[model samples]
Target chain A: EAGVAQSPRYKIIEKRQSVAFWCNPISGHATLYWYQQILGQGPKLLIQFQNNGVVDDSQLPKDRFSAERLKGVDSTLKIQPAKLEDSAVYLCASSPSDWSEQYFGPGTRLTVT
Target chain B: AQTVTQSQPEMSVQEAETVTLSCTYDTSESNYYLFWYKQPPSRQMILVIRQEAYKQQNATENRFSVNFQKAAKSFSLKISDSQLGDTAMYFCAFVSNNNDMRFGAGTRLTVKP
Candidate 1:
């Protein structure tokens, strides 16, 4: 049973630039999630997917942030014209179902200069 | 809307000692779930323990345990025989039947040897 996987463990980009992060959830997990954690803060839910369908994404900034899980397997989160406030860690997690314990990825730390 | 609160921003416990981290939540749903997650410097969020609202008995895993008070809407984590590996950022989370999860700001715990 492999854990969730994420790419680009560390990224640095100038403010107003675009960036994207990828996530590969654990096999057989039906629920996938994306969260953003700023320094000294807990992870904040950005989006959630249940079998390729968006379950929740109210906190996501629609003007700049977008995510997709088309095949119900891997997913990607993108930020267009990133801002300095976007410098944080992006975490991916997966769970078998609702209310189940989630397995998390190592996360990608993004730094906006 | 659900909210989780961690009153303690930072705490320190000597190795082999015991320490407790306080958490409180506000939710209108009668049935829900609570979780405690540990995020080390490696940037991976690990599930420490979980508790169901309906369950009367507290949840425990190895040296970690939780004291859940439903009436007061409080949930506290207790680490017994604390070890150096327990040092990390601890976050309290909540989720209800709607499957919308919320997290607290987190508490930084340092286990000194």
Candidate 2:
């Protein structure tokens, strides 16, 4: 079976510029998540969606970051006015349900200059 | 808030030998999930193994096994007869049954032949 899919495996942007990342989760999976992994650090959850509705996004930076899972099959994460600290690997993952093992996609590595 | 820790930033082992990666987490929830993920040079996050918090027996998959100490909030991964292909960044993650997942800082493992 095909795993989760993401677009633009790598991206580079200047500080204060805007960047967006896309994710297409596995078929039949009900839970989708976005995470940020800084170099030499573990991933931190940005947002989570169950179908077309958000389940949790408490850790998301409301002032600069936003994400949406509009039809429940695909999702997008956007960061406006990117900063140097925002340079990291953005990962997308999906699971069959709320409490199950997750399947991850090849992350989008964003480098902010 | 749950937090996972990987005290070791890096580790090295000779090919065909064994190596263990340590992890500890802080959480009050009793029913949860723990996972180990491998990220190779390609930047794909692959699930290596997982264990359920309530399960007393440790989880094992092929040459990969976990030593889960629920009371101690410890979960470690043991790779047996390691191979060069096993070299990668390993992350420890926690997911409560409520679906709140958190991850550690990650440990980079190198296998030298």
Candidate 3:
């Protein structure tokens, strides 16, 4: 039973640079999610997808943050023109269904200088 | 909108001792789920335990247990015989009937040997 996979584990970029993170969810999972965790804070949901269709993305910064789950297996989150406040850990999680417990991946930590 | 709160920012315990982390949530939904996730320095979100709102038995997972108070909207995690591996950031999360998940600001725990 492989868990959710994400890459790269860490990243560094200057302010206003563009960065992207990738995620591969567990097999047979139907729900995928993206979350952002700032220093000393718990994760906040950025977007959610259910088999290539978006379920929610109210917290996502539409101006610079965008995500896509093509084919419902793998997903990517991108942040263009990164800001210092965007330095955080981006986590990807998957669940068997819309209401099941989630399995998370090792997050991608982005440090914006 | 649902909100979760972890009033404690940090806590320490002697090895083999017990420690408790407090959490409270605000929501109007009757049926939902609660979860406790552990994030070590590695930044992986590991689910420690979970509880369903309809179940009043609370949730116990080995040395980890939860005290869920529906009336008071409180969910607390208790770790007995805490080990060095228990040192991590603990987050309390909530998911409403619509599957909207929200998390608290996490509590950092350190176990001293």
**Isolated chain A: TM-score per model?**
0.98, 0.98, 0.98
Residues B46-107 of candidate 3: C-alpha lDDT, one tens digit per residue: 99999999999989999999999999999999999999999999999999759567889999
Which runs of model 3 end up more than 4 angstroms from their true locations? Answer: none
Provide the lowest-lDDT 10-residue window in model 3 chain B.
B94-103
Q: What do the candidate models score in CA lDDT, each in turn?
A: 0.94, 0.93, 0.94
What is the C-alpha lDDT profile of model 2 across B1-113, one tens digit per residue?
Answer: 78899999999999999999999999989899999999998989899999998899999999999999998999999999999999999999999877577888889999999
User: What proportion of the real contacts between chains A and B does each prediction keep?
Assistant: 0.84, 0.81, 0.67
Ranked by DockQ from best down, the candidates are 2, 1, 3
lDDT of candidate 1 over A1-113, digit per residue (tens): 89999999999999999999999999999999999999988889999999999999999999999999988999999999899999999999999996677889999999999
TM-score for each of the candidates: 0.98, 0.97, 0.98
Give stretches of model 2 more than 4 Å off. Answer: none
TM per candidate, chain B: 0.98, 0.98, 0.98
Two-chain DockQ for each candidate model: 0.82, 0.83, 0.78
Ranked by TM-score, the better of candidates 2 and 3 is: 3
